[model samples]
Target: MAGRKRRTLTAPARIVLCLLLAGISGYFLYHCALDVLTTFQLKEQIAQNKSQISELEDEQTALQEQKEKLQDPEYLKYMVRGKYLVTKDGEQVFKLPTTQDDS
Candidate 1:
């Protein structure tokens, strides 16, 4: 009987196969790690943005209340006097002495 021929991979073929598998695995691992890091960063940003949004909303409410107050005649007069140093008709204004002028 004739001897059977054995089929085997050459050394170069084995090396190429190993390198291809390693490259594919490395690519998958790299992308997975990047995705995890990106998700964490996005979650942190969302949390920060939510806090900022709440703070801005609170400020907006306060500003709305102040707007309502300013629409009133009495409050508007008071605010104008305090902010612009304006006086109403026949209203005497008092000025405080500055600390630097005490010398």
Candidate 2:
């Protein structure tokens, strides 16, 4: 093996080798860029989902508090009287009219 001369590539063979290496590198680079973009989009989606979850949790807490308040009979009566305008027996209800302006 020591006595044998080393073999070298010709110009055409070196060109083909370089092109092959470049093609492989380009293929891997394209997939890597796609993966990076997908990761960024998924992270944005996760952040949006997290904010939505927090908003829903806050709404749930508020609804729970409202539910607890509604369980009280006095608060329930007050709400019915104020919102539904329910009057007790032999009670008179009054209404005020508002004027509207047209353009």
Per residue, candidate 2 scores C-alpha lDDT tens digits across 31-59 of 99999999999999999999999999999
TM-score of each: 0.74, 0.88
On the 0 to 100 scale, the lDDT of residue 19 in model 2 is: 100
lDDT of each: 0.94, 0.97
On lDDT, the leading prediction is 2
Model 1 residue pairs with clashes: none
With a 3 Å backbone cut-off (N, CA, C), the pairs that clash in candidate 2 are none
Candidate 1 per-residue lDDT over residues 1-103, each given as its tens digit:
3798878999999999999999999999999999999999999999999999999999999999999998999999888898788986898888887677566
